[model samples]
Target: MRKYSRKKKEIAVEDYVSGIKSGDRTMLARAITLVESHTNRHFTVAQQVIEQLGSVKTNSIRIGITGVPGAGKSTFIDSFGTYLCELGYRVAVLAVDPSSEVSKGSILGDKTRMERLSNNPRAFIRPSPSSGTLGGVNRKTRETIFLCEAAGFDIILIETVGVGQGEFVVRSMVDFFLLLVLTGAGDELQTMKKGIMELPDLVVVNKADGDNVSKAKQAMREYNTILHFLRPYTEGWTTKAVTASALEETGLIEIYKEIEQFIHMTRNNGIFEKRRTEQLKEWFDSSLKDKLYAQFFYDEKMKESLLQYEKLIIDGEKTVGNSVNELISLFLNKKE
Candidate 1:
């Protein structure tokens, strides 16, 4: 006879707090899982954990890294993060993986890609599924950042799922935004989104090694020329382009120094503090919207009405705008 193992006991809120405070990796991972849960029971526990640990503040900086496909984002992070670790900084990488549409499962292969950093004691890499969220980011990413900060990681790196409108979303939540590009800027820029070029705090022409060094430098020069004409995303700062080779692990220090300078300038000028407050407000507003949407859609009466309205709209019996208005009115009336 095959016997199934019994369910493990649920961890208490205090245990989660204590484990995270003491830097227990397992506990930190579990806490993040709880935060990512969509179930009501888990949501209640997660909220309680976040509320109790709200005072766990640290001098942490969240840097978002995004690039076009095949831009070596994971490779670059592996090198850059290892460098930060060597410099005595505890680094946390939140790698957002795209979910499979059919199965809704993520490969979560960041640890495999960033082998060196994954094995480093000072580095913590958490791979989360985007779960079809707008911007290809995990819905609970901001909350995950809070948990990482509470776990005493001073350097938080967010690797977005490719580059697109996700750049704007990541930029809003992060203190710094980095864009990576390959050689041949002339060709790449044509295909790149105009809005994306304006978002990066720094642009790096990666893969600058071997026979590609000259091309990489030329690309960097071209990027710098383009950046010169565009307004920098951060006020009181000039965004520039540099070259780096993740494979050879060269030019990492330059990137680190550039980020350090940006952080210093932002902090001194009060932009850093102001941005953090804005991020909190945005998180609150977004969460409120999410809860309201869930409440309306999950209501049994609303569900029945929604199905009827959907059928009518699909069959062209009712106008979409009118159906939407009726649905909103119904939801509001139900609340009353």
Candidate 2:
């Protein structure tokens, strides 16, 4: 292990903040890469960056976008983000890609899909691997959001891995959640019936160009009917569905307008502050749980005992639940 140097770390953090303030894209990317690193020395450096950036933190609008595979999320973000930048909003996109368990590598092809926005000076694109973490969010994502905010990005967009049960995780971290759907699938209503649609403040029907335009309109009608039966998650705010052609760059302005309206309504109604407080409480709880689990696994005696319990369960000497209970008891009862 390399010896930790406080002074060197401070200098690096200062450079990072300076680059961020001046809108240096390369330095922004390097800062995120450094923060995502797992080594102890890098962790210290990352913390220093966070502390230095804490004072002038960015208060950007955080938007979470999610959908099933093939819903054109990247295309939508690229077009929509570019539109935001054109309107003079600095945008930062954090695209989460699922990790391959076999090789522990990420495809991370979001930048390829978002060609235009990736090259924009006002936009920053980051593709992070899920790394088998729960909630489809990595440990570094929230930190990266902070860094981007500090960098003066007025709009922060988070594109989640559009896999099973991940939208809920994304919802916990963003101010507004948008669910994208493709039209003419006949299953649009069915998709909306799933839990993912329930969480979205706004549902967008993408690919509304070509022959799908009428069908997309019909799908929006169907979604409106379905939404009637579901209770709104945020008080005084009803979830809405709209259509857009991301490929043709149509209807994006209305989408942004709707988002602005939602934010205005929620903030005025005090629901936004309430949701943020709840989110912070959940974050602390989840962090504590992860730390406790790590400590348990790191303890030599507890690790050995866990292995024995696993063997006993496999050999039919104990049931899995009972073994886990005993292990938890042993871990909790241990003295320093």
lDDT of each: 0.84, 0.76
> Which residue pairs collide, candidate 1?
none
Q: Clash number for every model?
A: 0, 0
TM-score of 1: 0.86
lDDT per residue for candidate 2 within 121-200, as digits (tens), equals 88888876435433314446666777787778899998875665457666877889998988753564465435665788
- What are the models' TM-scores? 0.86, 0.79
Clashing pairs in 2: none
Q: Write the per-residue lDDT of candidate 1 for residues 1-336, one digit (tens) a residue.
A: 223454856788888888998999999999998777766566667877888887766899999998877889889999999999999999999855443333454433547899999999999998865364333133477888899999999999988645345567778899999999999998988777768889999999999999999999999999999999999999999999999999999989999999999999999999999999998888787667766766787678999999999999999999999999999998898754
**TM-score of model 2 relative to the true fold?**
0.79
Superposed Cα deviation of residue 101, candidate 2 (Å): 4.4
Q: Name the top lDDT candidate.
A: 1
Best by TM-score: 1
Model 2 bad stretches (over 4 Å)? 1-11, 55-57, 97-110, 130-138, 189-193, 286-336
